[model samples]
Target: MPYKPTVVLSAIEEHHSDGVFTHTTVSRARAAMVRAVQAIYPLYFETMSRPPIEVSDLMARDGEKVTVLVHRHNNLFRTPQLIAVEGRIITTAKATPLGLIIKGHRNRGIALAPTELVDAVPGWGETAISALRARCEAVRALLPRETAPLTAGAISAIPDDTADAASCTTVLLTSTQLPYEDPVHGCLWLVSDRTPGSGEDILNGVLLAPPTSSLVSEHGSIYAGQLPPYTAHLPTAAALTYAEALDLAGAINGKDPSRGYLSALARLDAQL
Candidate 1:
């Protein structure tokens, strides 16, 4: 799959009948496959105990705003749709009033993203067969369908830089809609949370170390697919002092303890 493991799944399914389709199969294998790839590459999420966005499901939501993750959608250049060329080269594509302008590496070769299928020329075009189509067909002939869901992988071998950081894993005091650039964990952070609903009494807390807890900076903004909610753009402890964090959070919501979660984050502020 030249495009992406996920995108390759989409392309192969669109043209060839041999591909992953079963919900349970995809569900079981997705994290494992993702984790395998993640072992080689640094995955955004510290843990992935969830389902992935299927391309078939994405096709269902035709025009609505959906998070388009190309190679994880970690770094999108303003435009959601970028160019994926053959020959192991990935460039970019931006829509102009005229048409989609595709540019090669360093803007060396420029071309229009072809709307219709033709001889592929490192430009955007519909393809009946993906790079994985032949390999997929061969693999299907070799393996049993039952084995698809049986595949599994591990992240135990993957190095953890935060090995020394105390796993102050505590209550689910908060859950952010968008990810902040974690200083220690990189992008797409999932801070430890614990929420127990079995009893009436609830004890809630979160892991907040001054070194790895805060966002990259307060001046900068990050985008997943489109603009995240205003609340997602939170202040980082590195960018502001503890007093500033408390003041800003209090000023926003003005609630008792619910005045934006920044007051709690003030503990992580290394400045002042």
Candidate 2:
């Protein structure tokens, strides 16, 4: 069988009668959900754990008795090596009254059933998990070729203190805007591949430039949350770890090391 793409699906089902996705609330909720998927994916992939297929819901008529039903689906493995977990965050008073409940069914294999009723939007949880899964799929597709020895781009130097002393290096992530506040001095820089062509060649091109003095960089700006910048100029295998590649770009840029130098070192160390 062809290898299926590994995914981590998280869905949030909201039982909000209000019918409104509040900007502030949704943003914060989404962030939290993304964080959960990020934390869970690594664990799931590292240790293969597959839970039995189950379905349950908190019914308002139950009057605090949360009811859930689970049935093992045939051909379960068809869904990729991905984690598809979802939850309903009901803002209504009904969801809050029932708390969480677990019940076993005789029809199914008779495994311990578990369910929870939380006070939040279910869609937030679902979307966050889905986002992580989708991102993982995308990254897998974007895996760089291993044939080439990763190269660094020419490093550009920027003055530490601009004419106004409020000077800072403008870290650009390809075309994205990843503005770093303060960069470290005389340190390495890192960046991610945003443009077409080989990431190594692009990095090498940036590194070949004159040394930069600014302490700001924007390596992981495009995928800011997922991929962050790293310190450049460290002795690590090129094209190995994602963090290292990013840091290598920083070193090549060298336009603003003061800020990203230490980060690069840490990222490189993580590769070990």
Candidate 3:
């Protein structure tokens, strides 16, 4: 005889008033029933001193009510290993040529008479399964998005006083906008002189110049600062040049880029 993986057979009947079953409904019902059983049985076993009572011992005596069983197997060295076991209850004890048939929620299966069955939890029946399924579905519906959105933040320097600042030419740059592209090498210029129209003058300059005298002449209205222009929509190549120029200028002024532009760049890199 071929060895069949041990399956537990119960003697319970699931009756539908409509007496109709569809493939989809039956599959769903079986899954729900299994989930219900799995959830309840663990808690029920935890209450016992020696939980998961063995199937052989539970089936030794007749008329003993059992809801779950712990199926045990032996390894190569004969060490007992516990494996997951499922049991079903049949509705009738009639001796048919195949075996006794058991019906679960929207499903049925055949099992032999005098089957080795054990119970783990009492009152574990189709009604309990249905109730548990409903509760699980309700809880699932209340959950938020399957995955949460990612968030990020950063802190950098900004100008403390815009008017009449004699100490430093530029203050730290701080903005919520992210710099997606590298700044133009030598073209990244900022004006911290607090001139009447310095902001507009800085904005008008062409980005990423090759550090020529004409480039400075074009935007000579305001004194240039070491900080890079952080305005959006600059091309990547230009942004790179500006970033390099900002770093060089910062180095020449003996100011650590981390105190300003470097910090902002680090935050953007983290997001990526």
Total clashing pairs for each candidate: 0, 45, 27
In model 1, what are the clashing residue pairs, if there are any? none
lDDT of 2 by residue, 1-272 (tens): 52122224222223555668532211222222222222222223332343222223333323232222111122222211223323222223433333222222212111222321111112324455455445445322221111111123322232221233121122222111226632222222233233333231122112211122332333322222222222222233132334445445556456543223333323333432
| Per-model root-mean-square deviation over C-alphas | 17.8, 18.8, 26.1
List the candidate 2 regions with Cα displacement exceeding 4 Å: 1-82, 90-132, 139-272
Tell me the lDDT of candidate 2.
Answer: 0.28
Q: In candidate 2, where is summed lDDT lowest over 10 consecutive residues?
A: 142-151
Candidate 3 per-residue lDDT, tens place, 19-138, comes to 695222122222222222322332233333434333334333333322333322233322212222223433334423222122222234333322222233333455444443443343
Residue-wise C-alpha lDDT for candidate 1, range 151-264, written one tens digit per residue: 111112212333432332211111122355421211122122122233321221222211123332221212222211111211232332334433443432343322133233
Which candidate should be chosen as best, given TM-score against the real structure?
Answer: 1
TM-score of each: 0.21, 0.19, 0.19
Judge candidate 1 at residue 262 and give its lDDT.
29
- What C-alpha lDDT does candidate 3 achieve relative to the native structure? 0.28
Positional deviation of residue 230's Cα in model 3 after best superposition, in angstroms: 51
Q: What lDDT does the true structure give each of the candidates?
A: 0.25, 0.28, 0.28
Least accurate 10 contiguous residues by lDDT in model 3? 147-156
